[model samples]
Target chain A: MPNGLDKPETTLEKIERMDRRIVFLAIAITIILPLIWPLGLPIGVSPQVDDFHEAIESIPDGSVVLFPNDYDPASKAELYPMTVAILHHFFKEDRNLKVIGLGLFPAGPPLLQKAFEEVAVDQYGAEYGKDFVNLGYKEGREIVMASMGESIPQTFPTDFFGTSIDSLPIMQGIKNYSDIAILVNVSAGYPGTKEWVQQVVSVFDVLMVSGTTGVSAPEYYPYYNSGQLAGMLEGLKGAAEYETLIEEQGIATSGMDAQSLGHLVIILFIIAGNVLFILNKRNKNRDRGGRF
Target chain B: MWELLGIWIQVFLTLAIFSFLYRDNPFYKFAEHLFVGVATGYWVVLQIRNVLIPNLFQPLFGEFSDPWLVIPLFLGLVLFMRLSDKYSYMSRWGMAAVVGIFSGLAIFGFGGGDLIIQIRSNVMPFIDTEAVQAFTQKAGVITFLNILSNPIFIIGVICVLFYFFFSTEHTGALGVVSKIGIYLLMISFGASYGNTVMARISLFIDRAQFGIVNWIPTVIIGILMIIAFVVLAITGKVDPKKQF
Candidate 1:
């Protein structure tokens, strides 16, 4: 070749610059195939999950469990199943629960209400304001939490359905964090389990556990190690494991096989892409007399 | 019937968004615009229903007995002053109040939770009996793991802190430890990245499940979309690459 530009591109170079559409297609296939006919891979229980389960199980029947649904539709795919599974466990144990939302502006409360309606009310025949109460979404994140820490009645005067707290049978003995046996925070992002820890649990000396997104999981490990969080569920895997513990094959369990297959596809792609990149670089170096 | 229609619309929208995998087109553009519009509208409705009516409206006029409710009601209204050019500065009062309260709260909240507790927790005993007891199920393997883990945590913390300690230049032993710190930092970062990748793929799997579980509606809408997209592509009415 007369010039570098005149030389024909190597196979590695061609592969390196290949259209990204093909990669997208491969990802699409990997996720879809497993869903259509699942591999049904076993989901091993983690020590963290075992701890979480034990913490909940240790609480006597009819103990008031504080559950904060702190996520939006964007994270519904990851966090929603966990919400249902936990509610199932709570109702199964006949635990008195209060579900609240201190999450995003609009999206959090309805999901909490829906979970209550489906799992607690319909499935378990839980009476409204007797078995569970939905306190709804409050505007201030940590501020609302801090206020609740001080006084639950002062922060939320009424439940989500516009019923005064005075009318609710569930709120009779519950005044603040002290009344709650355990605080279970299933969170997606900010003003979530971390915020709850900082604002309420540490202050009140309440036992707390969290189920957070996969990305937020590693960040909370220190808190878990420190005993700030008694236990935690990390993302969908956490949810699946929890579902397994409860012996209910819920949505999280259904998605686990697909999740495993998707991860495998991504790892394979990363390896293949790196190999091609290295080959292309070596070829270029050979052409340039090993200097460039 | 209405629920079925809603599901069909959802199916169409999902396909529309997914079509971008091929290339940018009008379908993707429509879906994108529709999502933003719907989301914004939904947010507005929820705020009014959940926040304003229940918190502000009911307390003020509807069977509310508290005089203290007026204070937050006034402050919340002050937050709306940003809409006016002349009164926008008044919004600062509301903003300042929020900042002041949170800052005061953070002194104890963030400081205690993140700093004090974290630091205290890291001061682990050189020999932890609880850890030893916890690992005793498989005595040999657990002992090895406990030994491996305890030192890594302590040493990693010390070295990483040293790496960040720029008051003095890293030299000799400090330099070597700092280099070790960098390795430890890389391992932590690699773990985080691997977990994040798993999370993202979980999201993809969810969307795929949605499509598969609702195959009939999704496939019907998808085929209709493909035909419409192809006709537009052939006619040069939509540029698949640059339509968005």
Candidate 2:
């Protein structure tokens, strides 16, 4: 009974029941090493991100681009790079950027302020009142979105920093959704892209694009296909792709080698698990006289 | 100097949270509580400063610019009454107003966006020779791939919708299409799961970047944590097996 198959069977069984912590350690190492020393794997651009860049690029220069800063610190790792990359694109192209944070009220406004300061103002030398404006966070969720469709200044009379809307040079000639050329949303979760689509994109004729959390991306494919969203960026991969499109090597791109390696590790683990399962099943069948 | 301090704090917290990978301990508990407390506090302060003051307090105090603002302010205050036993009933009026307004808006939004527009978009030409011609012109090929895509899309949509039709039992031809629907659903779910795994790993990679690249201090902190863990385990204060 202690034959060639039986000897290997014990090893397979051991692997099948291998300690989970070992697996966790492998994953941790797989992610960490690549991150410490990046391989710079080329990320293939998705048609969706291609469309997202094109949507922003297609808008005439100096036209208003209204997108929300709709995520917080929890999702900063994935969404922040997208935010920075997109903002960089907007500023570089000389677009009149109007930023807002209506959803995730408490979390998004401060992050949006930080993003604008870091990307739009500090990096691009974009004049605040003239080139871009931060509408800041407002509560009311979908209701605020609906209201913005009606009137921007009425919904937010003052910017996040307390500057009156009338005083901002960028506010000139931008009265409603009609004046806005495109709505680009880099969102994390609910009351984010879907709410915007329902309240703003569908109600008015504003062209919409979104960069959402990876988990929420599949459900939104319908919206993307339907033209409710002109283009979409799904999670960190999408963000990395956008950064590539803009010719900037940011955090998202830096993390991609780690991401690729991590994904490979997971897939290998899965394959190993399946092999173990199959071997165990075959051994059980052999024990049962070729499964009756 | 301030930046270094910030980096050190981040390292400490990151290591503290990662310690849970080993076992539940005081460090993990401390980090979790601190994260929740700080995030909640930050959110509340931001809402008050950015939203409440500028939107509500300014309008109420500075001028009676829009009297309708008072109505919402009253309703919002009434929401707090639920914390008390006797006045909890008064809170229902505010709750009802909120529910009623939201429901009404949702119905309108859903019907217009989710129902009509979504349906309209799906109602494509089953066979558009024009589209085929345009693709042929653009790509310089008379391939049937463009024409074939439409029929496949239409069939897939119908079959998937049919699978969700619970009113009738799937039998015979219906059963076959329903099986196809299940396959389609599985394919979509598998693709989605792949995306989710990538997203989650990216988060971990970001944390790794923070610990290893942005702050080498965290590696030292991580080592110190491991020593503490081992010490605790040796003293019988922790059970490493329990984590497994």
- List ranges where model 2 is wrong by over 4 Å: A1-9, A95-104, A289-292, B127-148
Error of 1 at A38 (Å): 1.7
> CAPRI band of model 2?
medium
Best prediction by TM-score: 1
In the range B11-87, model 1's lDDT, one tens digit per residue, is 88878888887778778899999989999998788777777777778777886666687887778789999999999
Candidate that would win on DockQ: 2
**In model 1, what is the error at residue B172, expressed in angstroms?**
3.6
Q: Chain A only: TM-score of every candidate?
A: 0.95, 0.91
The DockQ of each candidate is: 0.68, 0.71
**Candidate 2 residue lDDT tens string, A165-220:** 88887788777899888888878887788888888887897899999988889988
Alpha-carbon TM-score of each model against the true structure: 0.93, 0.92
Clashing pairs in 2: none
